[model samples]
Target: MDISLVAGLLALGAAVGFAAGMLGIGGGMLLVPFMTMLFTAKHFPQEHIVHMAIATSLATIMFTSISSVRAHHARRAVLWRVVKLLAPGILIGSWVGPWIGAQLNSSTLALAFAVFVAFSGTQMLLDKKPAAARELPPAPGMFAAGGVIGVLAGLVGAGGGFVSVPFMTWCNVKIHNAVATSAALGFPIALAGTLSNIYFGMKVPDLPASSLGFIYLPALLVISLASVSTAPLGARTAHSLPVKTLKKVFALLLYSLASYMLYKAFG
Candidate 1:
């Protein structure tokens, strides 16, 4: 790998890690479009770019989530019981989602990613609080919700925070608690998604060198290292900052990236 590329990936990872900690998004929403651009520049197989980007993005979250969650856990913000209830269904859904995504073509996947991200961003930007009477559901409902979050996250190569944060908040979880718990959930989402992507991608031919199934290994390593270093800082910042305002800013950034992805799918 070129030194310049490594440096670029490092910088990207730092930014992504901070975003992950601050927003509990696990950085995949930000990483995917950027990775797609990087892979394209490196002349990776065009048909496989989206898959590879998603896979690598998920893989990096494995590290970012751990570092971010540790910070949240230290702060006593993570709802361990919620995490426990949602995990089993999350694992199953995440494992299945990559398989389903593998059946789609690059254009279709890109289009889906674009649309999904736009919707998530819109939700964050609006920052609407749910009715006061609402509360988190029973165990069964939590599991079902986890399944949906996991499936959508796997499809988009995220850590499930895009959906999970909103879902928790709608259930009347405090915003900070929601973000913290979402960070914890990122681990399960990333693990299952990464394994599933690898399993499904092994059959695909003509992948780029230094690739592990759909994952671009070099990028994963470079990004993971930098991301872990910054995630704790982001988590600490999240505790002190105006996260709602930050979410609006981040949402704007998401809109821009989603537009680029839409162009990649069709143009």
Candidate 2:
């Protein structure tokens, strides 16, 4: 790989990792879009750029999620009961989402991603109430929510935190606990999405040498390694800061990014 590309990948990885750690997002919302832009700039085939971006982003998240989960686990904040309840649905939905995504036109997927991001960001902004303490939902509801989250995660290459945290919070889970549990959910989402991407890419032609299906191994390696190193810092920062202000800021940023993505998708 070229030094310039390596540097860029590292920088992007670090930034995305920190944001993921701090915001309880999977970081794909940031990484996939940016990586798509990078692939386009590099003159990659337009048909494959977004797929590559999504696959690579999911692959990178495997390590980032591990780091984030470990940090949250160390704090004893993860709700393993919820994780167990939700895993089956998440695994199934995540596996299916990328196959559905691959069948759609790339432009359509981009537009959908933009709309979803905007909606999610707006929800975060509007629902700014501090998390209320309450009992976990019945297993079925949590499982259903997990399936929905997993599908979205696989379709858009997210860590599932954007949806998971809100769902957990709305279900009366504490904010910190929700974030921690969301971090754990990232593992299944990443695993499922990565495998799906690999399977879907098998029939595609003329892919880059380093690619495994839609995933670019070099990009995955660079980003995942750097993201893992930086995630702990983000986790620590999340623990220290007042999350309300951070959520608002992140919401605004997501809005801006979403708008840009929409423009790219439709223009």
RMSD of each: 1.1, 1.7
Best by TM-score: 1
lDDT of 1 by residue, 52-149 (tens): 99999999999999999999999999999999999998999999888888999999999998998888789878888789999989999999999998
Model 2 lDDT tens row, 174-201? 7778777888888899999999999999
RMSD of 2: 1.7
lDDT value for model 1:
0.91
- Please give me the total number of clashing residue pairs in predicted model 1: 0
Question: TM-score of predicted model 1?
Answer: 0.97
RMSD of 1: 1.1
Model 2 residue 158 CA deviation in Å: 0.6
Clash pairs, candidate 1, are none
Per lDDT, the best of the predicted structures is 1
Model 1 Cα displacement at 99 (Å)? 0.6
